[model samples]
Target: MALLHRAELRPTKLDLLAAWLPSRRWFHGPAGADIVRVAGFRFDDPAGAVGIETMLVRAGDGSVHQVPLTYRGAPLEGADGWLVGTTDHSVLGPRWVYDGCGDPVYAAALAAAVLAGTGQAEEFFEVDGERKYREPSMTIASSGAGDAPVPAVGPPRRVVDADPALIVTDSVELVVLRCLDDGGGERAGAMLTGTWPGQPTPLPLAYAVPR
Candidate 1:
């Protein structure tokens, strides 16, 4: 079996981000914008062949965002559904990017991290302390058949200031959404963020909840 090398020669987290950020849909700037790594941490697969990293980055304009990524030594077949991108390694020669949510290796690692209490976010906040708008809380639920519809777990709650840890449930499929605060200081909008796994240009599902 192949194994991940353990050595300092591995590129720093920022180095990987510098090469990756430009390719994301949420990235708002041109390729030349400077990116600074504010914080980063790694997650390891049990077999030692895959490594996952969650990075917090601040762009030149000082916008902060979170990026979750997985790195593998070789391509994982049957994982096309989760592929994000493949590129020359600059140092390692060739590399493949997989969506951490679908790739089994990454999924297992992520689930373990969440269960172990290692990958949860401690706090969340809005940009510039804005109160009129806010982001939604994200949750990952599992399906038995791998193609089950996501159930409405609960009423939409405020995530404008929640630092939620990534959650992995045995029965729930993952759900991503955005919550907007109504004029009454309560959440009023629910917008679904679809599952893409490795899709590079993912589009959000149309807003479905009542305004």
Candidate 2:
């Protein structure tokens, strides 16, 4: 089952950002906001070969942003259109940007994780204590099947008054959880947590559920 390796990786977090952030549509910077490495973590693919990382970086203005990246050994030919960058391994180089949404390796791994019942993220609920989960805007690239269905929690309820639970699935169960936090900021505060079939559990709080 396709997996990511998490050992002896060479690229420093900054190297990753220099090659990644500029390629994303959501990256808000003047193209000169020098990136300062902050913190990051690696997740092992269930197959134990591919590597997924969630990195936090601060720009020159002290703005912090999260960058989620996937790495692969050889080039994923014909998939260059989906990649952000590629370079030879100076120290085991020869890596390619595996778009989590479109890269087949990552797509299947994520699907398996979701199907295995382990992949969760947080979303903002309304003020009445209701949580609404939306499908991510990103697409997983793979010759595999389409996206797994995200289960609904019944009709929309009051965000502040109801004590609801969050669940996700893809023909099989993925994650289930009760209320974690109240709505705050410009949105509600609902965190998601679960484990994938063969991969490490992603930190649900690491990313705000993509709107």
Candidate 3:
């Protein structure tokens, strides 16, 4: 279960995204444009080493964009280029945030969810010594590859970004979809999909196809 903190974050998630979004090719907006977070969901990191999240944001022009993020306790080794920035968390003390595509933790979690046919983890909060679950704004799903049906999640050796397929692991090639697309790829080995709040249909979020 993912825990929600009631404390304040020094720079804030929106602030970091606002600064980083302007630098990405997919983001179409002025640097000062007001970004509204529409919907999001979290993927579990089995070891709890990193906090994985994906947010769907509306740009100034009302265009929707999907951003996958990973929060870590310390700076990720050999990931300086992918660092979004670090912020002081009132609850966790400090956190290092990244773009997620380059994060091994996020990659592994994506692979596991895609091949294991799991869905988004339910969010829970501790209230008066009891755990209460709250439905997320979006629903996420994943499915196994074709007939082989991956037996396990393998650690990735590297992530070579070239669209459609990104991560190279012992098992399969994981695809990272920066912007949610629903057009094609009906033949992908496995995929992680999500349905935005109030949306009846799901879109491909990530995928795992044969290497």
Tell me the alpha-carbon RMSD of every candidate: 14.3, 15.4, 2.5
lDDT of 3 by residue, 14-42 (tens): 88988887787666565578888989988
The prediction achieving the highest lDDT against the true structure is: 3
Global lDDT for candidate 3?
Answer: 0.75
Candidate 2 local lDDT, residue 196: 29
Per-residue alpha-carbon lDDT of candidate 2 for residues 170-203, written as tens digits (9 for 90 to 100): 2221111111222211323223232222224333
- What does candidate 1 score in Cα RMSD to the true structure? 14.3
Against the reference, the lDDT scores of all candidates come to: 0.41, 0.41, 0.75
lDDT of 2 at 64: 43
Model 1, span 1-211: residue lDDT tens: 1222323333454555666656655454445777775544455555655656555466676444555566766887766645656655554556676645445554444433322323322233233443232222332222122223333222122211111112233432222221111111222222222222232232332121211
How far out, in Å, is residue 89 in model 3? Answer: 1.0
**1 or 3, which is superior by lDDT?**
3
TM-score of every prediction relative to native: 0.45, 0.47, 0.87
TM-score ranking, high to low = 3, 2, 1
